[model samples]
Target: MTTDPREAGPRPPFPGEQQQERPGLTSKMTPAPDHGETSYVGKGLLTDRVALITGGDSGIGRAVSIAYAREGADVAISYLDAEQSDAEETARWVEQAGRRALLLPGDLRDEDHCRALVARTVAELGRIDILVNNAAAQTINDGLDDVTAHDLEGAFRANVFAMYYLAQAAVPHMRPGSAIVNSTSQQAKVADSTMLIYAATKGAIASLTIGLSNLLAPKGIRVNCVAPGPIWTPIQPIAKTPEQIEQLGADTPLGRAGQPAELAPAYVLLASREGSYMSGALVPVTGGTPMY
Candidate 1:
C-alpha cells in the first residue's frame, strides 16, 4: 500500500504517445496509461445516481467512468465518433462494476450536440445528477504566427463553448445537490507560450467554474474544477513532440507524469455528499507544481 511518490506512475521517455488524430486513443500508447482497471475500490458513495461525463471514452474520462460506476453511479460517457472502440472498452468496465454505461458519441463543438448529450443522459439514465465536463482540445504552436484561426475557433468551441452549452442544458434537468465538475488545466495559471490557445481556453474555464458555482449555489448544485499538471494521457501524445513527451512531468517536483487513476478521486469527492459545502473550489492535482 505504500509506494514511493516519485515512482507512483510511469515517468517520461514514453515511446510513441503520438497519434495521427486530434483525440488520441488509449490502446495505441506503449505502456498504456492506467485507468484503475484493477485498482480503485469504491464505497458506494454515489448509489443510484447518474453521471454524464464528456470525453469519457479514454484517459481521465475513462478513469472517472470506472470510479463513478464502482461508487454506484450509472454513467453516460460522451466522446467523438472516432473513439467508439475506446468508448466500448470504457463501457465494459462500468458494466463490470454493475452500473449502466451509456455511450454517446458526437462533436462537442456543436451547440445542439452538447444539448443532446444532456438530454440523452437524462432520458436514458433516468436523470443527470452529475455532469463532468472533461473533454477539451489542445494544440501546440511555435509562435503567434503559427496559431491559425480554425484551430483557435475549434479550441474555444470545444473547451469553452461546450461547457456553457452543456451546463445550460443540464441545469434544468438536475435537482438540488447535483454537481458539475469541469476539468481545467495547470496551463491556465502557469501560462505556456506554445499552448496559447489551450491556456486561454482553460483560463476561461476556470473563470466560468467560479461564476457557475455561484449561479448554481441557490439550487444546491456544486460547481468545481480540477487543474491537473502534466499527465500521461493521450492528449500528450497528440499535442506534443516526441521530445516534449519524453520529458513530460519530469519538471514537476514529483518527477513523473500523473496517471489517469490519480485524478479520479478528486472528481468523485466533488460529486459526493462529502463535498456538500465545497463550491467554486479549484483543486490542483499538479504533482508538486504550485497552481496559485
Candidate 2:
C-alpha cells in the first residue's frame, strides 16, 4: 500500500499540552515522534564511515543518528548532560542497526568540551568521516528590550561558537572525501522578530558553511548545511507557548509541522558519497518554506 507523505502520520497534538524540562525527552512527548525505526531502509550508502553528531540525543539529531547507523556508519552522539536518558535511547537505536554507538555527555557551549568531543570521537571511533553540528539553544524574546546580554552571548556560544570549535578540532583528523553538515534553520532566511538572536546565529552558520566549503575544498572536504522548518521536536515545548504551539506550521505552505524522521534523509544524502560533488550548498527541508 502506498501512503501520501502529507498524510503519513497524525498531525502532532495541537499546543503540546505537556511540557518537560529543557531538552525534553521523547518518552514524555504526547504522541511519540517517528524516527524511522521501522520505516527507513538503507542500502549501505555510508558503509564503514564514522559520524559525530551534536544534539544527537533527540529531535532531528536523534533521527540523523538512526539514519547514519542504518546506512552502515558508526555513530558518536554528543548531548547535554541532562539528556543522558535521551542520548541512551539514541545509542540504542544506533547499536540496533549493527553499528558502534558512542555517547558523549557534556555541554557543547564550552570550547574545551567541543574540542574534547572531537578528540574523543576520533579516539573512540577511529576517525571522523561525518561531522554534524546540530546542537543549538535559544530563548524567547518579544523584542530588543527583552533580549539580555547574557541571552545574546549564550545563544552564540552554543549555536555558532561550538560549531567552529568542533570544526577546528575535527578538520585536522578529517581526510579527503569527509563531509560536514551544519544545521541551520528556515529562520535564517525568514527572520522572526522574537527569535532575533537565534535567527542571527543560524545566518552565521549559513555563512560559515559557504566559507568553509571554499576553504576546505582544496583539501577535498565538503561543507554544507540543512535549513529545517518547524519540525516537531523536543525544543518546541520549551521554545513555544501552548497557544503558539497550537498554531505551529500553520503558515507554512505545507500547512503542518514536519517530523524529525522527515528531515533525516536530507542529512543522509548530503553525508554520503553521492554528495561528493556537492558542497557549499544549502539544502532546505522546510516543507515548502522558500529559502529565498
Off by over 4 Å in 1: 16-19
lDDT value for model 1: 0.93
TM-score of candidate 1 on Cα atoms, chains taken together = 0.98
How many angstroms is residue 273 displaced in model 2 relative to the true structure, after the best TM-score fit?
0.8
Q: Tens digit of lDDT per residue, candidate 1, span 208-236?
A: 99999999999999999999999888888
Task: Give per-residue CA lDDT, model 2, range 134-198, as digits (tens).
Answer: 99996778868998899899999999999999999999999999999999999899989889999
Q: Best candidate per TM-score, number?
A: 1
RMSD versus native structure for model 2: 1.2
TM-score of each: 0.98, 0.97
